[model samples]
Target: MNGAVSPLMQLLSEVETLKKQIAESEDPVLKESVGSTINAIVAYGQEAYSEMTQILDEFETFQKMEGLTEEQRNSLLAQSLDHFKDQMSDHEKDSFAKSCEDEYKGIWESLDGDSQEFLSTARYLGYALRMRGRGNYAPVINEMCRVFENELKKKIYNDYIVQMTQKQVVDMDSNTEPIKTAVSKKKKNKDYFISDTEMVCFIEALPSVKNNQSGYLSELKKYLQAEKWDIQKLSDSQYTKSAHNYIDNYRNDSAHANLMDEKKAEKCDRQTHKIIKHFIESKK
Candidate 1:
């Protein structure tokens, strides 16, 4: 029989053996490390660590089959293990795509079908979760900001612009006039930028029992002929504020920053999810 063995198989075997020994040894530090290694392997999805054991067991059974020669058995054993790995790889991708559907279980139930579809397709949340699961926090931080900025763009565009033709948007009302002037006259030909702080102020200006016709919301409703959104969501809420602060604090620096340890990563991940689910709820 050929003695050649796959390096990946050897490494996985070492990890499993180390995991088992650490389990029985009562060394908290080693056990913690082993758990972390397993988690890294499972970034695609859970059960990857268990999948290794299942492959080994199947290969052992295949090795004992009577018909094949020892050489054939060894070759087939490697093939079986490789096949299992391939299956796991494919399953990992499937898990990622599927998780995009409902991983934000917190707000999934609150969204309408269209809202659910939009949030699911956002993809940044999925990317961030995958990074966090792999013990990588930098991409997670970026994804969190991506959720905020892109969703805000989507909300404004779909809610307001889609309803009007180009001429109507410019000629329809006085509210859009300032927007037109800002876009055309700004230095560097810069477009008007939307911001979370501005949103907070705008929401505060929305008509209440006292004032009904003199605010950003009222003017927006006039020119754009736009309907109200989940206005409460656009307000200065804990989730919204945190999401804004997360973008401000991390987005610029995360690219060149050092890797965060698990504790920091955990906090980052939780905040990312908070931002994602909050946006999901805010979707109109």
Candidate 2:
């Protein structure tokens, strides 16, 4: 029954509790202040934890020095610990310790009696560096990533999904119809929402599209190569059909009379096809 706790676990518990209390608070001002404080605490806790881990990792790297000794390591640790401590206020430091404690408590509560002793061991390991009073985080950070690359990847992916979900929700509620239309299209055709990074990757994967133009040429080349995409291959009758689709897709002429009178050659996708046909013929 040896009980030990981590600062991170403790901080997280406080945050959860504070969040609950904030939600129930009678005073609006108090609730707002509590929420803001909780946010700052959590933000600082994460940043400090990451920085401390990185510092430890760097110190570990220095351990390889030709004349590195226990005394040297302790001295460096002590100095770095003081520097990190000075970077935060007493309240922030306490918040960080509480976060670790909350994090450890969760793990301990989740375990069965058979492995209860593991809680103390895990907490000891988690808090050992903090107890050591040092801030060489580089080695610890590097080691953690090397050991948990998959976990890191999962975290990154989860974060991206959360962000995109929020963005999509907001886009749906936007007052601007243009933005709403874009959002609807993105929702309908996920591929159309391809991020700039994904688009670049797609273009690079298409080697044949490698004209002097960047990825733009790649996409253009793709369209040119498609069986249904070639303008020259299309008959005059097909052009008329495509022009109608283009106008129907882009032009908002709901009335039949409007469509008849404003035939300023509807253009758009049809015009693009004509331009591409000219280029293709010139090249031939």
Candidate 3:
């Protein structure tokens, strides 16, 4: 009869066995306690299995790529790694980034190049997984990808002059009349490299905002109201109550319209929310 038992049937049978053992015990109190414990175990198992089924269903919903082949994936992986490897002097340095290298290569070898965009697309998914520590973030992933794409485009534009200056065709001598005009690329003034110490300080000084609906909104509001946004001052705990309406208005303004895709906007909101939480935790 056991030869054809389903998984649920097997678990139920085990529970029945436990119940029988508990019922047959000589000690009355011991029997009662054992029965209670067995019931709890069965209940816990059922709940855990239900949650696992829900997670599997959700995992199945991730965007699937069609027309991708294992060979093409391997080719792209080799190309990406070879391009990076060519820049390195020693195999040791190249091998130092082994995990990243192996993951990309393995992924490529498993899939095809028809889904070339998936390389960039998967980045945020990986980052969010690492950052949030494994949970549901379907909409968040879409938003992060949108933000990453925009940032990449900005980086390309910002590096254009640097790339040209390094080319052999470009004139370095001031005395000689150059065939092409000297391109002076404007430095983007953005605070991307805030020190961890400053971040910690900011977190410690954060007001006692309850980590609820009001807390999330309030933290974002602090960033929106920030007057200078200077990295140096980020570490200093100052009492400056700024309006979220101002930041919210600025977020909606046409000046930032170019960056305001629905996905990116959502991501931006989430990032801000996280920063606030980070700040609060650091202060503690």
lDDT: which is higher, 1 or 2?
1
Model 1 C-alpha lDDT per residue in residues 161-243, reported as the tens digit of each score: 32333332324445345444443444334444444344434444443413344433454544322344555564435655675
Clashing pairs in 3: 69-112, 73-108, 203-279, 204-283
Best model number under TM-score: 1
What stretches of model 1 exceed 4 Å from their correct place? 1-91, 100-102, 106-136, 158-228, 236-239, 255-259
lDDT of 2: 0.38
Count of backbone clashes, every candidate in sequence: 0, 37, 4
Total backbone collisions, model 2: 37
Residue 184 CA displacement from its true place in model 2, Å: 82
Give lDDT: candidate 1, residue 203: 42
lDDT of 3 at 221: 27
Q: TM-score order of candidates, best first?
A: 1, 2, 3
| Per-residue lDDT of model 3, residues 1-104, tens digit only | 00112233345557778788876789888888877877776896576445544432333232232353433332333343233223323432333333323444
Model 1 worst lDDT window (10 residues): 1-10
